[model samples]
Target: MRDPFAPDFFETPVAPEPPAPVEPVQPVPSFPHRPARSMAAAMLAAGLVVGSVAGGAVGAVLVSHRNTGTSPNAVATVAPGVGAPAASPGSFAAIYQQAKNGVVTINASTSSGGPRSFSQAEGSGIVVDTQGDILTNAHVISGANQIRVTFSDGRTTTGQVKGVDQSADLAVVKVSVSADQLHPLPLGNSDSLQVGDTALAIGSPFGLQGSFTAGIISGLNRGTTAPNGRALTGMIQTDAPINPGNSGGALLDGRGQLIGVNDSIQSPVEGNVGVGFAIPVNRAASLLPSLEKGVAIQHPWLGISGQTLTASTADQLGLSEKSGVLVVQVVPGGPSAKAGLRADGQASANDDVITAIDGHSITTIEELTQYLDTKNVGDRVTLSVTRNGQHISIGVTLGNFQAQPSATP
Candidate 1:
């Protein structure tokens, strides 16, 4: 399996003054290859880059900082959740008009090593409520000493990072402003979105504020890596021409309701190649309560890596299970190891095949991951496993996903 964290496989744009380089963390182990399909190959071809558009001098860099501390004094106002009405699809122009005001331009400045040197990063954000709670990508404000938010009405104000979840690449910024100065966008159900469904993206692309683009939801349940090298599953893939500075922007449906957050682009070059990935709004909405409270969100980690087993692959490998996840490696001292789950050894025999989790059948990595996403850290779950053709259930406790330093040039 090829390394997905290879230098050439991913790039992040940084600007103005470059910060001191940090040590690159080790890459996650590769999963077993499928017979005719390889996820790693596809990722390599479509290089992933953090889509925060940079101004001034551009350089290749990726910076990630994790802050899980709670702030008791911080307060945020979240928009009320409303279901999307059953209305006819609106035109892109109509959608833009409805959602443009809810989007804002974000500028974050990070201090360099020098006493007076600082670097600026620019991206877009969505106003979730009239009280000035804005949602953006975590990478946009990571390690920032100061933040500035520009509203659609040309109003600019100082912003504060209320909360950030780097594992999901999401953050919340708050500003002190009157309710009349804000326009909150309603959150839509991303699960209702389908292939060919209309997707309108509004953001500051290349510092172009209020830039709007139209495309269809090209794919669903796509998996990608976050800026911190954590796996982000159940992503919404689109060809909406999302560029740098579009990060943390809104991906709305035809009804002008927010469905996803523009996160990253898959392009060999720095520019968009019509392939962009967005974090599902449902996930973002789920995290809003905790994020708005200035409480860092911690994702549940299973602490194991594996590949989805198919009928063809099972027959080829002479395995017992036709469809399941083949446990290739389990991290020592991790939750799976603590639960006594067996991993494939050097002999590749006696490997444990995970068929289900808490009575939910999982046939693909995406299914397993999506199920896990709904769970909280420290939750106890039962894993249905098949080891040497014997079925058994193992109870395991989940743990928080630790952010690792990723290799970024």
Candidate 2:
């Protein structure tokens, strides 16, 4: 998220520099010569940075120039920074130091086994309040009969699930760690994040506790398919390496404020591929109030199955607007159906479109989701629609998605 008053993100810390490049040596007239293969190998090794982050893939390659009999001591000029300059190391170190106490490594097992051989799994969490509430990924503790939380200070205690939203892939866990074992992490505004901004991820990636990686925000407002089979919108995309165990970890900004929750990674192999997605803190933050209250949180459903509008359809419908959602279907007896909203059909010939919601123009599902996410269940919204040859507005009360009947509606 960008700070309007400040040009640079004040929270994110800088990344550590790659190792300095090594130069191949030309034998001095009297010095004993090492084997050519050995010299080449040494040169190759020197060019690598060797960090665990997937962002370093390109940096791990060897870059060489043709031999022109230059002095062995020659050095080539590398770019000032790779991809994009990340936050400075000293700043990151401070952020990590400040937030480390708030993050805890989670261990879970089954009650059927004795303490020694209990089923064990590791994940990360962030302390959201002084009340010992920890926010983590639901998959981390799912199906575990018992949960054990190990704070950054190495203290272990049993934890209880406060509230779990499987659709959101988030679970709020509670451990009775007193104030002494905690430091609450500051949540930032993820809605303002833009591409090219710095992102710092800290977690126990691949079981390596307190591991840190830095990269740029490659994209924002991304649609993500959660491990729990829910489609999450408004996701933050980063180049930072987010391994399996890193789920629920903190995605910090330049100033070290928590901007996102590390949750999913895109990779062909099991290893990192530099493309990772995080749940925007703003999204998580919005839902947490109800979660902490121990109530089942509900989202306002539009009751319409729609796809993004295309240019051809926009022109055909005479609604050549940039912001509109093309309605594909309206579920029978659902809110949309009851509201008398029409979906694409032979009569209209798929010419009608939803141009706005409650006065807000929405061009894409991302915008539509954001509009819906801000509202609670039972809130009435007005949809501005175009049909045949006229524009009309319809009022519809958003329904709780969880309350929708599983049977055909």
What is each predicted model's overall lDDT from 0 to 1?
A: 0.68, 0.61
Judging by lDDT against the true structure, name the best candidate.
Answer: 1
Q: Tens digit of lDDT per residue, candidate 2, span 185-282?
A: 76666778889877888876544556688887998877654333333577788887676557778888766778888876665443566777777876
Lowest lDDT 10-residue stretch of candidate 1: 37-46
The per-prediction CA RMSD against the true structure, in angstroms, equals 15.2, 17.7
Q: What is the Cα-based TM-score of model 2? A: 0.67
In candidate 2, stretches whose alpha carbon ends up further than 4 angstroms from where it belongs are 1-89, 109-121, 225-231, 268-271, 312-323, 343-352, 388-390, 403-409
TM-score of 1: 0.73
